[model samples]
Target: MSEEKDLFQIKSCGGRKEADEIKKLLEQNDISAEVKEREKDFVVLVPNSEDIVNEALVIITSQEVYDEFYAGE
Candidate 1:
């Protein structure tokens, strides 16, 4: 198994669709994202390099906030 340091988790999701939603969001925004399956949860990952992790996290957080605020719409 690759060490956690190799890839940083942007979000931990309950299911494959949940993980894929944000993964697609990141790719649509031109940021690379990866999905890793854990025993209990799925996680979205980005390279550990500082070059993109911050931006990825920002997008991830922003998308999540947007979804939360507008979910009922």
Candidate 2:
């Protein structure tokens, strides 16, 4: 593992509930993960079409972890 301080974004989850679950899995696999909240925008086209903003969490990890758990996603 290179001494890289650079952290990479691995996955973006819609909510914290899902983010935490993923975090647990990653940690169990020996990959440290962090969850950060970000703005999420979605368009709903039912009844009244409108753009909705929501809070989303993303998974962050080191380069080595990212490479090890890429999953081709």
Please name the candidate that would achieve the greatest lDDT relative to the true structure.
1
Best by TM-score: 1
lDDT string for model 1 (1-73, tens) is 2666788888899999999998999899887788999999999998788877889888878877998999978
lDDT values, one for every candidate: 0.86, 0.45
Candidate 2 per-residue C-alpha lDDT over 1-73 given as tens digits, one digit per residue, 9 for 90 to 100? 2222334445667777866666675666545556667777211111111211111121233433676778666
Q: What clash count does candidate 1 reach? A: 0
The true-versus-predicted C-alpha distance at residue 20 of model 2, in Å, is 0.7
Q: How close is candidate 2 to the true structure, as a TM-score?
A: 0.47
Those runs of model 1 whose alpha carbons end farther than 4 Å from true positions after fitting are 1-5
Tell me which residue pairs clash in candidate 2.
none
lDDT of 2 at 53: 11
